[model samples]
Target: MNSPVALFQELVQAGPPADAAVHFDTACVLGGSIAGLLAARVLSDRARRVVIIEPDDLPVDPGPRTGVPQDRQVHTLLPAGHQWLERWVPGITKDAQDRGASLVGPDQALTAVNGVPLAADGEDHHLLAIGRPLLETLIRQHITSIPNVSVLKARASGLQYRDDEVSAVRYVTTTRADGDEQVLQADFVVDAMGRSSRLSHWLGDAGYDVPRLERLEAPINYASARFDRPETTAELKISGVLELFTPDYPSHGVSVAAANAIEGQQWLVMLMGYGDNRPGRTMEEFRSACAQLPEIFAEVTAGAVRGGVVTYHQAESRRRHFSGLSRFPARLVSMGDAVASFNPVYGQGMSSAALHASCLAAYLGSDADLDQAAHAFFDLQQVVVDAAWAISAGGDTARLDAESGAQVPEDIRQQRWAMNQITAATVLDADIARAFNYVTFMLRHPATLADPDLLARAVTVNEAARVTR
Candidate 1:
């Protein structure tokens, strides 16, 4: 059997199957969010029929739904995520851009980590900055356009098992007064139900042990609002991000300015806080929070027209240890936030989901046994989860000593310090900035920051900054 990495490479190169060749009879995906949509698209290539079970009536236009509370929040697709999405759904980025999404290169954006401005010379990665709702809507449209994929408006209640393998999904339609229940039989089932997933309970009901959960308590809050972009600020061109996270100041915030999907000149500004420092609900309070942020945010919102304020709170980042389970049911797999959810501040959730979709596609494309494929998929998915978990949870650990428990090892602490120093030195050296940007954009692993040559340059730059100060 080809290794997961080798299979993924082959899958990416070969692209989707030439025709709708059926490898499975039926595949059902629980949840119609980005993760499920992506999974359905991949499953459509292998299954004769694909069904996505979602609770809410999906929007025809880019609009908010009660199911996705964070739909209104600012979302940026890392370069790696954008690449996978483009590969899976060809011309997706172009479709989004045609609808008002902006493709921003590294040089085009104003970015400041801690308080130092990142040097702009060596940034080659470009990001898609669009509203989350619009992105999801576009993906849903694409997935439903596939010949074999269909979405049902129903809530997934449980899984029906024949012995150890899941055979069908039990669901109840939301439209009925009595809530009539239905069963959809499938050869494969995927849980893409986000953080609110009940896969553990369903597994336990099927006589399987529930996976243990690993959590990092970050306790973050966000207050955001859209605003009319000042015509004078057009010269800034790219979006602006101001992130301040340090050991001394555990209370950190981020401000992002991006073009709205409907209105090109309008932008959304989000203000976030860590721990007990929450952003205000009123427009004045939101602006006050922005004022306390870096100078760039304050200037952007100084005379800008305000929109309605929205607030969200996240208590922890969680990962289900599904890969560690000794015995797992066959024909069942979990993806997206159902398996792992990260702190939203890091913007890793959607991108990580895209990577998981890629892994699923690789596994389905191979000739691996169905039962063994579950294990292989979990193992490969963990690789994606760990990379994102380390960045999000490790970042929280670096800011608050109280949150930095045994889960954060000593080596990770040292690595975080090295990365912080490198970020600080980016203000002086553009090469260091470019290397750091690569890690941030998920194009490369965090281990790249510790390269001997890069570390040496970081040390020299830090020493020069120290002398200048």
Candidate 2:
């Protein structure tokens, strides 16, 4: 099977035929978030009209809104995600860079899994460091600019079905009361309403069985704040991340010196902890939390002007098993956090969403039946979700094995040990570091790190490090 990256490359090289037939007259996206915008962008090519129904009147500028509470948190576009966005929205990276966003090598901001600074290997694997709000705004601007795409400020109330097929979307304008609902007929309806989606409830109401849900409860919490980049630390262009979420240690700290897309030199620092070790909202507590992780966090935060601190709590990572459902409504699909939401600390949500959008595009471009597209899209989306889940929730599960009273299988245990050696080897070997970076960025599969040759080198490096210690 082709990787998502390869599929995207093929799509880019073989642009849609000029005389391609339209499959649908109209498509409705239930949310105006990143996932919805990307989906609408793709739908514009195959559908005569695409409507993005959102509750909030999106801002014209780069600023936080109430719709996405996590917009203020630290965010970076992984290399794979950056490529997808650039392909979907031409000149998007340049547009963001022109407005103070920076594209920096991943090594500049990364620390090895063992708390050692990663070596600068001079390889060019650039990742985007811009505010999440700015990224969303730019994407929205691009999608809305397409001739067939438009935005409507309204809240999706439910799905209206004709016989057994999804036929229309019921919604109410933001200014209107509940009784004054309106319906928009659509050939297709997509739910990109993030983790708060009501699609499952709406499905149950429509007499369809709700999909089974799989959840991993890590019970993690985060506290994030922006700070003026200290003049003393201006020379350091990279960010600092100290992850200590092993079975022994459950706290993590990250200080990202991202170029604010709107203006000014600022660093977004976020501290995360699992269960009872949650980070505090106060400045002093934040400092104390950082002091517990690594010295770099305290050093960078010292003498820095602070911004408002925001806290968020997440009980679990969730996945709805839509692909496993015996029956699903025709002409309806879900994407982004609505389908699967991972632990944000792993930074896989946005990239996974981008990959899902690519899957949607691939399905839309096919000659398959529209009524059966939901199953095919969900099957493809499950692959993307599985990879992300293994990376984020899998790590959390491994770290909390003892606390959760879960037993790791023997084969899985060996794999984890090999992965640990690879992580340790990254501090000494640039090649290993590159492989680790690629896996972390979702550009490559984790299995790539466990190749026989690589594993041999990692074991050797691990033994040498142990002897020296």
Candidate 3:
């Protein structure tokens, strides 16, 4: 008899007694980052008030905000991410395209996998690569457009909790005229503060100890440059996409046209690392990285119409192990980079965030409890993110397996064998390719490849291809 949204509102507003409405009136989001804003947007429906706190002064025009350094960088919403965004924001993808965002077909752009060129058969897979800041600007505007959300320019200095539950969000924020300390009370608190979350320290302050933490370095470095699209190239108005390497070379590059309008019309070239290799920023080094695959990257840039070098750094793959924790707060949740960060080379961050947001919507729609929601969220997120990571890291694992004293142990050989088949099969069979594309796009589960019928098809098809090769 009641709407899903209405039921979710009731659940969020209710007390520990679950069925009783304790009247949760306020919620605060840390960092005003993408994740934070999305969380605020969702919470706004239930809370009497919602505030978005950020350390930097937000601009009136869409530009890079100080908070997210990756803002100026290139970001892509994989199909999985696209579907997830549609669920939460609804029509935002269309808005992005209408507002000058280019939509390219899956194989339309340059993408190389496993040393072989992905045939741009001109169908199915699609990628929406835009500047991070541009995408963030659109999302920020949408959040502001929402009726009950407000933005606050403040850096969350710390957090406060009571009765083993998050009680308040503390911050030291600066305004146009002055700066001051603030403590906003709420029935819920969300740490959407990106990879720099202080939830661990905040928990310690409240006398809670972190049970488990696992952090590893992918040792990735990013160097980007903007170049002029070749005038001779007729696809100027086309969604220009470029790529290098196939499968696990542990490195790749992307050359995407500007999102909307950058004062100057140009395309962006971003080269990045996965296991240990990094994208070089210098014109020479950058060209060298592109040179590895002279068929597309270097050749296209050779005729590039315009832009210059801009290099950056990101090293590390982290997971908070929050799901393994025995106790956690309800109504209080997180998504995006706040949960896990991937090797940026894959451009899976936004999509992973979107998938997580979709989880929130799914859990809210059902009668799942807080614990159930958190667990379900992470479980699903692991698939979305790890699918991309596996492909990215699987390449690394290949190199490791080839060398002596590899970091990955021998316990997962069987798993790796199956993955190898899937990899080989996708290259030969369109059926396998479609299945693989679905996983890469976050459209299907990674385990889908393991299906007996599908795996048999992959094996049969790949075996035939090998004889021809």
**TM-score of model 2 vs. true structure:** 0.90
Best first by lDDT, ranked = 1, 2, 3
TM-score of 1: 0.91
Tens digits of per-residue lDDT, candidate 2, 101-128, equal 7676554566544356665555677677
Point to the candidate with the largest lDDT.
1
Q: In model 1, where do residues sit more than 4 Å from their true spots?
A: 1-21, 230-232, 245-264, 302-306, 402-413
Compose the digit string of candidate 1's lDDT tens values, residues 1-469.
5453344333334346666456788999999998899899889988999999999978798889988998887777887778778888998889988987777776566666565667875646767878788899999998899989999999999988876778899999999789778899988999999998999987877768788988888887777777766668756665645465454543334433223222355577777777776776789887776666666666556545646888889899999987857667888899999999988877788878887887787677656688542887787777778777877887777767645445567887677778777877877898898887766676666656778798789889999889988
lDDT digits (tens) for residues 125-196 of candidate 3: 567656666677778888878887898777787776665566778777675355566788876667788887
Candidate 3 lowest-lDDT run of ten: 255-264
| Model 2 CA deviation exceeding 4 Å by range | 1-20, 119-122, 230-232, 239-263, 303-306
Q: Candidate 3, 60: how far from true, in Å?
A: 3.0
Cα TM-score per model: 0.91, 0.90, 0.82
Model 1 lDDT, full chain set? 0.77
Ten contiguous residues with the weakest lDDT in model 2 = 254-263
